[model samples]
Target: MKYFRVDLITATPNPQRCIYVGMHQDYSESFVGENRINWPDEKKAGEICVKRLLAGERGHYGPMEHVQIVFNIGWFPHSVMQQARTHRIGVSFDVQSMRYTGNRINQVAKGLLDIEEVFYLRPIGHYVDRKGRRYNYTQTQRNIDLQYCEQAAKRYYDLIEDGFAEEHARGILPFDYRQHFIVSFTLRGLLHFLDLRSKRDAQLEIRELCRLIWPHLENWAPEFAAWYQQKRLYKARLAP
Candidate 1:
């Protein structure tokens, strides 16, 4: 199984500056001119922006929409990507098409070669039980699952080689098959995504993905990230 990857491609040139500009739109009268307003102290501006966001001030979140972050993610299971696409507002995605890539199994005259090397997500349930106890799949069960996947891959290859279109052949692929995509999201949308997907109750795969991505976001906006961590606002909806 291949490890999931999330690569930060790019982000807003000056995230804090963008937020400050939006804040200034509401408080323009407070400054004499654009030159008079604090121009380059992003740390200080980020601090003020974080304050407003934490305090529930009007228009604070609206400014976050201007700061965008982009990522190139890959080798994650298809099910996780499908779930991720539900965050349609303020986010964009360009996913790899199975119709174009086809099933990527290696074939040999004897049988499927490198079947053990095929990328698939390990079943988390095999390692941990519902109560968080360590659990191991019986060897019999493990072999059955592996054989099933190998047979499926073989059938996929056979279908493609026998004149089936790539799109039709992809129907045999499992949800655990690895996939890739490029995705972008505004700061506000990203925060919303983390708030929902990073929770303890979220699917293990996506929760892990969010945890891996969180540190990079924190590095980009320390003040706001601190506020988010301290407040635990991600669980606010679960509160009574």
Candidate 2:
């Protein structure tokens, strides 16, 4: 059970902007998709370039501002709050703050809480029944948490309706409740972020987002993308 949805709303340099800036090497604006490059084949490209980039054996790469990408990340409230601290790549989120607009909740915009990150620890009963059974509890607890959150949110809304202060009512909302955000960054910044967040040491939630974005960018900028992949992705076998 996944607790969130991550979408690449828009990326830059836009195909038009790339054309305007003469960044397009092989395709025209009309023919080019949003990023100007299509990449079902460039998965290997990232693997090659990201390794070299992270090794400090950089051949040629400039400042991080060459390319820009924006992500619409939908996740539990706790995740968004934690992710807000990831300022290395110019990250920003549209948080549902109770103090801001009072009880005027944006019902239309708030994404539903989907259980994604945390896995449930099942009881010993299942394990004893089946030796190889690896049943996940993500969906189970999510259902539980979601029901609790909904009731809490509803109660909070009721409190506000009855003249309670927004701040006080919002206390009921759990950190795992849904929240949305927009993260943007330049190519260089993204590279740095990837080096840090895409590693095994990074948080699983953020790492997932980085993994998804890497492939999307490969087709858009093969040269730059390749370089990044060589420098960062293959950090294991490559020399330091």
Q: Per-residue lDDT for 6-39 in model 1, tens only?
A: 8999998768877877877776765524564556
lDDT of each: 0.72, 0.52
**Cα misplacement distance, residue 229 of candidate 1 (Å):** 1.2
Clashing pairs in 1: none
What TM-score number comes out for model 2? 0.57
The sequence of per-residue lDDT tens digits that candidate 2 reaches over residues 1-240 is 254566787876432233233323333445435553553233443333444333356533342355577777665345635764655554445654657643323231133422222211122222212344445446676578556655665676677778888788767665555555677766666666676667765555566667667876675666666666665562532221
Model 1 weakest lDDT span, ten residues long: 106-115
Q: Candidate 1: lDDT of 68? A: 89
Model 1 scores a TM of 0.84
